[model samples]
Target: MSTVFWAIVVLGALIFVHELGHFLVARMMGVRVLVFSLGFGPRIAGWSRGAGETEYRLSLIPLGGYVKMLGENEEEDEEKDQSGHPVVVADAPDSFANQGVWSRIAIVFAGPAFNFLFALMVLVMAFMLGVGELLPVVGSVSRGMPAEQAGLRVGDRVVAINEQPVTRWEVLSQTIKRSEGVPLRFTVERPEGPILLTIQPRVQEMTNIFGETVRTWLVGIGPGSGTEFVTYGFFSALVKGVEHAWRMTDMIVTGVWKIITRSIPADQIGGPLMIAEMAGKTAEQGASSMLFFMALISINLGILNLLPIPVLDGGHLLFFLIEAVKGSPLSEQVRLQANRAGMFLLIVLMAWAMKNDLTRIFSDG
Candidate 1:
């Protein structure tokens, strides 16, 4: 029950944020919106300020939501009879179809933009609320490892590597991994005084979380149980939040590329069940952890929507780009076929993800 609840809460909130972006931008661009729905399928409940106003709805399906605007469908602007003659309809000034190309692009792009913005906001809050980080203190030096050979002992607190200060374990580990087997100078604080030691990292074969075997440099030192709740002021948090979001975006983009190149297994893709499981686990960890998880998901959602595939915001932007270049919209038949292909691709992808999720569930059981 807890898992299901948190899943719904997180997914629902993100979907609402996405659709709200389109709604606001469409209204601002003078497009008349007909529906603002939180989900798909039949309307569960809804309200409107008055007749012909945009009807806000909670729908039966929770997988996704959408916003409907006047003249949003390009097909509606054109039709043909059995005799193969073009039938044209008058365009409404406030309809989406009648808007300028740039205006339409802005309205379509708003969904992903809002997602990124929401992620930035939550990350700032998460940082302000304090995040737990492991201090760069060595708890144990592996026997026969480079650290042991270099005389790095237990209780040694690393202050710097090659004169560069590292306060957190994550930074320290990444630095070591990227050292490329080069000898590094480490400055550690001892009871007597600070000591400088030179140690060379060794290339070791390791399996990554993706089940791929890869080689990386390692010193074989583990962090101690020294953790601190680090908090930042408002301005500092804002800077950190932006940096974090950028890092996440880069990481996600790289991951997507890897998957496309077959560097990562396709079966790793997951669907709603996987998200629900993760949401439940994070909620149990605490609000800060949950927020962090949400930020990551929000970033993922933003990047995913920006993919230039048909039936997505990115796809619409692609269409607008082609129209701008050609000085006209694509033929209605071509747009319709492209949209159908995109829809088919999405359905297959969804089904594959669902299969993967169920496989993991049953395998775990």
Candidate 2:
């Protein structure tokens, strides 16, 4: 099915880009990678490659991939002379753990960086292929809806919300969603002309296509039907692609901030189930649409990985930052203890997200 294919394709590309970051950086840092695998678990097909003892592979599981750099675990390799302390590889140039803090940091951070870049590439490509922004036109207004009550009519161009100019329909939607039930002063351009309206949103339970209910503040307005695929010049695509990535990054940052600040509900969290659902549907639409979603998710992945929580790149980065400030790495004992703490925290977070996802998935039905 197209959905399954797209889901797999997106997940595969994401894992590949992430692993590629680690692999390339390891190579650059002179670390010997034992294996660069496109998937996890038992290898279905693989082979060792030029100048390294590592196997470049396609494994059984497509969910994840890894770059198994030499000296990564420090427990597996045992080439000691007399004592239990292992002998260091003096000959092999590329060893991940052997690299300095900055190099290691760079290697770790590259995964997320590449994801963002990949997303940017997708956005730029879509734009170059002629993706048009949605027009600012009201789709529906409930009889007693805020828009109707405030005299906001159809075919109105929503120029601004709370005096903040919105150039894109996407921006307008996001602004309204995050307004926190405030009485929003919207500058709408009706057929007769522009007018300011104080539109108040009420908390309403809305059912999605999946039959899941979401309690959201509704402003009772929607953008007009359809978007045109507007092709772009190569240069413009590149520039716009980066802008798209930056915008996504910003949105993710703000969303996280809002969650932490209690401006948004904790139930809004999601995990793989939500993502896979989106990916499956998006993939069926075609490359351009899939690409758009991929870029969005890439930015999501990038930002998510950067959260300073343990068992994540951000957690590792946080440790590195502390090491940088302290003029030495955290003690192995401290690192291990912190890691345990992080692992616990990460599990809790995942559990929460998964719980929310499950609740949303089943409750409406």
The lDDT leader among the candidates is: 1
lDDT of each: 0.90, 0.79
Q: On a 0 to 100 scale, what is the lDDT of residue 79 in model 2?
A: 49
Task: Please report the TM-score between candidate 1 and the true structure.
Answer: 0.91
Q: Evaluate model 2: give its TM-score.
A: 0.74
lDDT of 1 at 300: 89
lDDT of 1 by residue, 1-365 (tens): 99999999899989998999999999999898889999999999999999668999999999999998878875544434469786442266778888999999999999999999999999999999998999999998999999999999999999999999989999899999999999999999999999999999999899876677999999989999999999999999999999999988888888878888999988988899999999999999988888888888888888888888888999999999999999999988888899999999889989999999999999999
Any runs in candidate 2 off by more than 4 Å, and if so which? Answer: 41-45, 50-52, 58-62, 79-86, 89-92, 136-222
For model 2, how does the per-residue alpha-carbon lDDT over 1-365 read when each residue is reduced to its tens digit? 65567677788889888888878877887787788899879989988756447788999978668777777666665445456666775323456666778988998898888888788888988887676678666777778888899998777788888889876788887777787898999998877778999998878898743334778888887778855456789998898887777877887888788778877777788876677778888766766778899988888888888998866788889988888889887887887888899889877878998898799879966
